[model samples]
Target: MPWLATAVTTVGLLSTGAAHADTFVPLPGGEISRTLGDGTVVTVRLVGESATISPSMGATPVHRNAWVSGRAEVQVAGGIKKGSIQPGYVVGCQVDIAGGGVDGGASGKTDWEGNASGGLTSGGNLSLGPGEATSFVILDRESANDYGDESHSSANSFKGSEASVTWADSTIGLSGCAGYAQARAFVKVKVQTETIRTVVTLWGQPFSLG
Candidate 1:
């Protein structure tokens, strides 16, 4: 894992004669390798992760906003090479999301759904009170189904041994939370081999939303 110091800069001024600053946080993305029952090794990597925290347009203490970016890569070896990757983020309002009760490694089988303190949403814009959290997928790809009907999916499928997904400037807006807030990124990969199928997840470092 590679770590970089976080950087903050004053981007502009607010309407209330207050100096508004945007915080740029450089995250140390991670990598993890998992071995399947059939001796297949699946590797997941998260790279170039960062977030820009900006003051919300509401300009109130209860409102927060951020722009996140990252890249997720997957490589499968020694088995049938087909997999899917889903990238997402979890936002917490006054709730501990610092990998508590979860494996604190480059990759882990953390139960994201169980750890979430609130209901999940399809989009980034959210509202939560204290001690609540939610997760949302970043990709909403639009495509035609087999019958030529419009469809939307959050995961991207790929064949062969290697595939990657990149996202930039994904918006996260939170309101109704009057306390401190935090967020973390995750990449979930599902791999299928001739003998078995497995899923691996990679979690990024948690960052503040103040």
Candidate 2:
């Protein structure tokens, strides 16, 4: 299965330019920078997920039927405040640049959910065993203020000093959510309003899980 990370990397980084004349000229180390029509520059930085869970033994009574569920929520920086995100930028399931130097942020939830469900039918005792796991993440980016003083909303959980995941090898957990065997969810944003040309690099990764 092509890890959802790829989708995150592709759509997460440069999906808006996929249709228009916006060509995604790959930058060194999967980085790309481009200026929109207005004169605002947005930089793309693909950070990796950190948290992981190794395949291990789960609570078991060797029962014929058992079930379980797990969930996780990640915290990200930036919100409906100035400097939190590029002025006049919009964010959604897929990051889209609507031209201009503004940073428009989309409103909604910022949590990714996944689960693993199955049944342990042994000895014909009629037992169903289901398990689930969830996690959270924090994405941070550097914004240049060369274009003057800009304001940004602050996210509830965007403030903090946390470690990041460097690679995708970090196993998170199992998924039982229909069509989520390989699930990937995250937040994205687009830059619209700006005064001068500056660079903003997105940075974040899933939190760790034992």
Candidate 3:
């Protein structure tokens, strides 16, 4: 369905941190905000052109549609939260949209209607160790079915694991594994309401290549 472009604006502070240190941009009194709570809307003004939109979480690039008539309110965050803007958030960027609705190679795909604008924060991560297998379940609280969505699991032990994520409006999931040495296996995941999807990461010594 097509949506009407809703303009919004707010005041906020835009800070930039260094890779090895903490930095600040001080986006004070700029008429642009990046921390709009749930249900809060804001507007954004593009300079004679539209900008790319996508969750700034990790490496996940989920795309969506949003039009910034003048500005947009920062609504949701991926996982971390601090005031309106998280520790790693940019102002004037709340909703997550594809770059000009063109082929910007966004992580996730979505539909659009009015001008597309917004920001995104990516959540959910998966990792596997050598000769390791795992499983994951997906759930949606807004649905009657406890398993509102599909589940995923890793069958064969693998030397590594690969992660692939997909999302709709507010729903996201992932699949794929790495280093499976031709082993037979089956994995299952269940989605239910009140799903507390946490990030799974494996930490260990680096593998050497001969």
Candidate 4:
């Protein structure tokens, strides 16, 4: 009887572990690298992420809220294939964060902040309130690339490697809120080249505001 009980417990443990094995676990701070077909390599890394209590933007010191911030670093090599004609790509990296929180104060009870980052252009962006945001310069682009597309411009170009970016969002805070948060870093380019056309995605560890 004792041996049978032990075997049943082992089976239960194994079942629980198998259920979580396929879960997508995010890293708090890590690096991911990808090489494209033509001969381009891009690496995106997050040094760290933090949350703090700061004064409200328009309100007085009487108000407190969560401020989320992170440092994004990138390393790129062999990403250009310039020519007289043919197709070319301007490759670079971008940083983004997706998360939600709840405020304890008179502010909105539910806070959901998504896609807040300067994507491959103007370096990076700090978190704006809910709908409004600003672009923060982390790794500056050497020169704005123009692929002769009207709808697109150089403002969204992170054309070089070895660039650094720092971003902070006042609205996506937890001073008076608590919930979940996620940080993501990815590579972006105007057009896909023979090389440089792969899905480059990396995620940081999730955050909890208590």
Candidate 5:
């Protein structure tokens, strides 16, 4: 929970900027539980979700900016021993994402290959036209690989029955979209037992970005 505490402190610092042209929106975080073929239960939850929307720095309708924060928690049962948690967001421009899930390859998880990277950059800066959407992991963790070279990953691996990841004031900047925009959060957890592996995803409620 040390990371969570750090995130809390960051949130406090970020929230102080609310005096500007920022619109604070509270999100109704969600939870989902899935049972694997081997009867292993995996549960994922998104909590303390929120967004602070700000006017475009460019002073144009085609630009938007937001600061998002949330915590993703995972619980595994039925003798599951390990798993990985991937937390991300999907953003849409003049498109409906409230129904959950995006098509046309707009829905994808971050690869764990260390060197692999997602479509959106670590800063969450994106440019999309109308009816376009994209997904990106929020974490950009850096470490040394087996060869002692630099590596990056978006997911956190965990052992035992429970694990959680917290993020605060993550930026989401969009441009080149003339219409309304929206975004939603997702937490994907992959749980593995000695003989079985399963993945469960939890989606948060979509909210307007404009």
Candidate 6:
């Protein structure tokens, strides 16, 4: 199985030019950028992302499984407000399987609902393990902590300091969620203060995983 980073694939960064929303462009090494309506820019450069599929180690023989993991450095610059009341940009990733897990079709869903950590290299070295969460989820922490950098956010851990964040590897064992699929790392910005109401997001190009 070969890794499909954006640099080598035809599925390059694509975004909407419309003025109503944010812009997204895929970058190399799973990187992506989102420009907000207020001219604020949030960049998320993925150091690496990976996925694994295998028979479950659980005693239950009825299911197989796949685990998806992502890691990246994030930052915010220009037009960012300080001490805003709304939740700031959210940096995270998700998995979209072709087979759709155990159901193997339209009935399958997205989201891995796992715990996330913040740092400079939290998810960069994650690997499939015997014990893992049942689904994928966004990184959630009450404070704004950088991966030892100078970043700050009102509601997320990735505010200041080009913090590193990761959605630790999680399992998707339904038949519909099995097989090869695309994994996407993305960023979202939401600032709802008394003066500005901007919501924008940028999704990095998808990569192959099985």
The numbered model that scores best in TM-score is 5
Q: How well is each residue in 1-210 modelled by candidate 3, as lDDT tens digits?
A: 122222223222222334422121111111222323332223221111112122222332221111111111122233322111110111111211111211211123211211112222222233323333222211111222256753211111111111111112221122222222111001111111122321111111111110
State every prediction's TM-score relative to the real structure. 0.81, 0.27, 0.17, 0.39, 0.85, 0.41
**Ranked candidates, highest lDDT first:** 5, 1, 6, 4, 2, 3
TM-score of 1: 0.81
* Candidate 3 error regions (>4 Å): 1-20, 28-71, 74-105, 111-147, 150-210
What does each candidate score in C-alpha RMSD?
7.6, 18.5, 20.8, 19.0, 3.7, 15.1
Q: Hey, what RMSD does candidate 4 come out at?
A: 19.0
As a TM-score, model 6 comes out at 0.41
Candidate 2 versus truth, CA RMSD in Å, comes to 18.5
Q: Candidate 4: where are CA atoms >4 Å away?
A: 1-27, 53-64, 81-156, 173-195
lDDT of 2 at 22: 20
Which ranges in model 5 have alpha carbons more than 4 Å from their true place? Answer: 1-20, 101-121
Q: Which candidate number maximizes lDDT?
A: 5
TM-score for candidate 3, residues paired by index = 0.17
Best of the two (4, 6) by lDDT? 6
Residues 90-174 of candidate 4 have per-residue lDDT tens digits of 1111212342121111111111111112343332222323232222222222332376533312212233344444544323321
| lDDT of candidate 4 at residue 133, scale 0 to 100 | 21
